[model samples]
Target: MGTHVIKMPDIGEGIAEVELSQWHVQVGDLVVEDQVLADVMTDKAMVDIPSPVHGKVIALGGQPGEVMAVGSILISIEVEGAGNVREGSEAPPAKPAPAPVSEKPVEVAVVEPVAKPAAVPAPAPTRAAPVARQPDERPLASPAVRKRAWDAGIELRFVHGSGPAGRILHDDLDAYLAQAEQPAQNVSSRYARRTDEEQIPVIGLRRKIAQRMQDATRRAAHFSYVEEVDVTALEELRVHLNHQHGDSRGKLTLLPFLVRALVVALRDFPQINVRYDDEAQVITRHGAVHVGVAAQTDGGLMVPVLRHAESLDLWSSADEINRLAKAARSGKATREEMSGSTITLTSLGALGGIVSTPVLNLPEVAIVGVNRIVERPVVIKGQIVVRKMMNLSSSFDHRVVDGMDAAQFIQAIRGLLEQPACLFVE
Candidate 1:
């Protein structure tokens, strides 16, 4: 009989491969069309792959937690009526009884790992109670919810669900926390005994973010130079412009203005807008500017690019940046918008950081870091007065961009911000 092979399908853009995070089917199991076969983690997000045809699984191509490329064979299936067959191999031997067409296919149960035997045996009286829900009778839940429960150290069996088919929701986490109660001590006593130390396991998105940052730092040659800029006039102009425009729905943020300033700065310092050719030992400068705004998502760090950023007006830039950032945060950014960035801009003001040295996006020569603009008392005209100020830090690849060029590029940006009128000049 004929056998069918299922190959992995495209899950995302520019992502040729993904890590198989979970496998739902195994050898000798019956699967149907649209049934989830596995979950794969792409660069942007995690997606569940479904079976394309009905069949009994024969073998899997890769193990869970292993990365596999797109279009690679994922599983081999034995089609109904057409038994398992191999190329140039002998036919299957006849069974003792003919296989019934109407009879349900028997599933070959997967053997789970057996833990080591306990040191002591339990009492016979308490040994037997009642069997819990069988696998088929149990309610269905999304793999993400199950993973969250597992990570929170909560038993799935004990949690109540509020989703379709009785699936668990994130709100159920509160009940889990309530079930996990503390006892046997007063708060004062517990606090007295508590040492000023805590241990947290790094897992999920935070863990992945940490790993990627470590990788970026380890692989790229990063050189950062910080310059403090007086943005008092810029901030005042922004406020006045916003009031005059009166676009309540689309209030201008410091970012779009910053992006506009950067575009102008790059017009003069194009080297800062180029990508480094690590292999060819050359820097390829782009005629157009595609600026990526680094956004923090629930999954991890995602940088969404605005194509032809230099050609857009300040309002259009603000609108698109707003849309792209929103999309990235919602995990709906398209692949094209997530890739092909010649440079990037990172902001940590919402989190309240004064200054930071951001790591370079590989293949890209530089990244600009935006910090908080606060009112700090300073000596202006030999008198102490509250003035709005911010620090801008630009990190560049020393292999491609010289220190003088980097410094001047950053200074040009500062000059534009301080002048506020040069950004609009021809």
Candidate 2:
């Protein structure tokens, strides 16, 4: 018998180490090639590590939650039989066949049927044996689709693939779900609900976000200021812009204009763009503006920073934001896209909240909250008129920014929005 060591393989990008989540085999247990031996978790996804050869497991390096680097030895296995040293490759030795049973005559039948001088039969011609069946090979779906199937408790293998080359697609899953007449698959039991709630351990991206949010809250003395702005004129400009240049020109969302207005305001008041150095008791006032747009994702919250926002025009800023948001939603966002944000903006326009107190993005002095815009009655030149109004609420680190400074910053943005011509000024 010979021993073979198994090492961890690279599973995801920017992942230096992984948490050993689970082990499926134990010592002395025989495992086969391609059998899943353990589950490892990186920052992005959980991947199963399979055995490459047939062998009996001899030792485990560590338990679950223990961080292991890539290429680190995970398990040791002992190969069986001579020259079958390839771990987890050879089939387990077959058990010995049971011995044959014998029967005899009831009465004294005597003599073993008189030793018939038996003639040896001619040797039978030999034939070759049939080959063993090979393992199944089907086209795999995208990892995102696979994850969705797992979340919905659906088996991808059983689903009829209708995608290219018989590969499973998201639409295929949707079609199956639409036509399925099986009993309702309840995600959780209503009657079995416990009075005591079970706590789910937050790991991966969610954990990282939680840590940063907590630090932001604890370190910054936040004060929120809210004001309602009449965006009818801005909306009119957007509609005109869209009419001139169709959707192909760009998705003329109000965010770009808002970002532009913020940029202009920051140029005038650079102190508001500063990050507080809590330990050094100093503030880093950046000359160049980098704005982080918080995008909600299936995995958790991800903020993709728009670098050098001060230098980019409104159209360019809109295009970059659109591309980054798409990437974030598709789980294709990179580490660089997520870090080095000097400021952040979060919009709950869809949820329709009138006002909200946005927590400061740590070390950074501010976060801007955009609330839903709806029609409201306002007196215009002594005549009550219906207009689209939205609340712009900004939370700032009070230690660095006073209430007057915060109000002035919002006022400057309001001025730019009120007079859209100001955005064109250098």
Candidate 3:
């Protein structure tokens, strides 16, 4: 018999550590080679770690939500044959050999002892004693409720538990946050005076976003430009196209038209399709157009790229966009699908306002934002007309793209959108 230790392998992109999102097998569970064991999440993507050898799991290294370093011992397994035992060869003399086939399974603790709850302060003589909790007992709350409280900087302990047996519910956390946001005078009148403030730890995807935004703000000089486009003709063309091929093909969205227009504009202005090398201090231009579409998922914002978008037609572009967006929202997009974009496009659909200054996705030179389209009266050819007007809000890295080039690129898109037929003029 031999025992093998499985170490965390380098998942992708030179990532050093990953958050253990879930565990599929527990200790003492017999697993086979290539069987999935756990799901780990990095900043770029979520990856499933597979078992390397067919064996019985003896121990697990960590629990879910714990950050594990690469090359660290992930889990140990006891295999049948005395083949190559790479990690643990010096077996203890107490258990000279493996247990017989008829023996019961070993019972080892699977949960790690890393994420212990914070120590509670002693209650004052005037107040009742706090509820006793086991050392390993975790706070009883759903993952969504915990995430909401974490995002709102509310501690779970301070939140009054309304669920059965002192469980925290989503409504309880919401009510606590809503009350906390009220005026100090109102809060004092409604509840007892409190002097403590909750401190929430920033981790996971939110931490990555915060760090990247800080880097972008410090490294790049952002300049925003907003222009209103008359999309009445474009909308008419879109509706006609959807009606003609909506059943056979995918439903056409404004994004494909916008993407086509951007491709044309990029051909005219190649400077926007460039990436910056801060260390080398150079801008590298690419011939291929890999456009990224910013998608808001339950986890956070994810940008899934549409590779070689310049070669795809309106229908193909719309199909790929829908597929990528759905994958991102469902947390199923691969790393390749989420990376390697030269520029990005973000839209809020019907929720888009009149104007918004979007932040530049780092290393990329520009980002395009789509605003809500509203119909209003306007003058066209010296005649009163009711037109659908939408605003295009774009931000550029001032260090790379000049103001004139930015204005001209957006103008090119505006012209194409206004004359809808020009978008198909190869």
Candidate 4:
């Protein structure tokens, strides 16, 4: 029996350390070559550490959320014949104690010293249901308790109160709910006092997201500007184009149109298409428009960059967005696909409300957030008319972009969207 040790591989790009996100094969589990043993998270991407030789895992070098240096021993495996690690040339990490295996959680309690009780049987006390009040009488409950009762469609007046002076309390409401007979859903089950909790270690992409978000907020002076855009003409154009080219190409979405508008709008606002380097005290303006589209995935929010928005047309940009979004969600997006953006665009689709203050993607000075489009009444010339309206809630690094410049930049996008033809015009 010999031991083979696997060290954390360098993820490259000057990354010194990475977080041990997860372990697929625990101690004593046999693994095959090319089988993923663990997952490590870099600042930009999740890299899978795979097994090179078939063996049984003997030790785990680190726990989840531990930042391990490159070339550090990751896992030790027992292999057939003489393994690469010979007779402890270097000391391996101490094997972690195995967790207690159980089907259900056990609570620890201190034994109390007490006198023996008498052999007398105790009878259960019977309490009648609280008398239901008249429908005209309002139940005395705090606003929060009343809100809960109101949300549950339970008239507090009909619910019996056990509080002093018949004032209803949250626990009283819980008791009433527990006693009530419900057929569709067992509402009483929700009244149970829960002592169970799960502790999820913040690791992988979630930790990276938290770090970047905190860094962005801490390093950059952020300010937000909101503007409403009338997209009646743009939506009509999108629908018409989709109708004509739906079979040949693909269905048109608002994303492609927004990208087109941003690309066009950036021509006049080159200052907004620049990355600010805080340490270097310098800003580099790029002619190319690399738009990072924020995608919500199973792991966390990832921004997959669209290489050059200027080069790709509407459908091409849409295709790339869909592809990158899929890759991000599936944890297949490359580091290149996730980085090097001059600006970012974020939207919550149907979930997007009237306004949202978005965080700036670090290094990039601006992030444009799209809100849901709604048909609202607006006066065109003299009379009130219904029009498709959307709001752009964008944030900028105040140190790099002035308030006036940010406002004008959003106004430019609004103009390009309102006049859809100008997005294609030079």
TM per prediction: 0.65, 0.60, 0.72, 0.80
Q: Estimate the TM-score for candidate 4.
A: 0.80
The local distance difference test score of each candidate is 0.77, 0.78, 0.84, 0.89
Which should have the higher lDDT, number 2 or number 3? Answer: 3
How many clashes does the backbone of model 4 have? 0
Better of 1 and 3 by lDDT: 3
**What 10-residue stretch in candidate 3 is worst by lDDT?**
91-100
Ranking by lDDT: 4, 3, 2, 1
| Model 1 segments more than 4 A misplaced | 1-4, 10-16, 22-39, 42-64, 75-189, 192-212, 246-249
Q: What's model 3's lDDT at 80?
A: 86
Kindly give the stretch of ten consecutive residues in candidate 1 with the minimal lDDT sum.
Answer: 91-100
lDDT of 2 by residue, 1-426 (tens): 777677778764667888777678777689999999987655533467899879888777667657888877788777665433365674333222233345763576556656778897565333233223225764468999988888988877667666555667787787667657544444336545457778876754566567778988888898999988998999899899888885677758888888888899998788899878889998888987889898888867777889889888778998999899888777566656766788888887678499899988877898888998899999999999999898998999999999998999998988888788888898
In candidate 4, what are the lDDT values of residues 155-183, reduced to their tens digit? 87766666666778777777667667555
Better candidate by lDDT, 2 or 4: 4
Assess candidate 2 and give its TM-score to the true structure. Answer: 0.60
**Cα lDDT of model 1 by residue, 19-128, tens digit:** 77667977778999999987766664556678877888777777765677888777777776644356677443311222336667778899999999878734323122
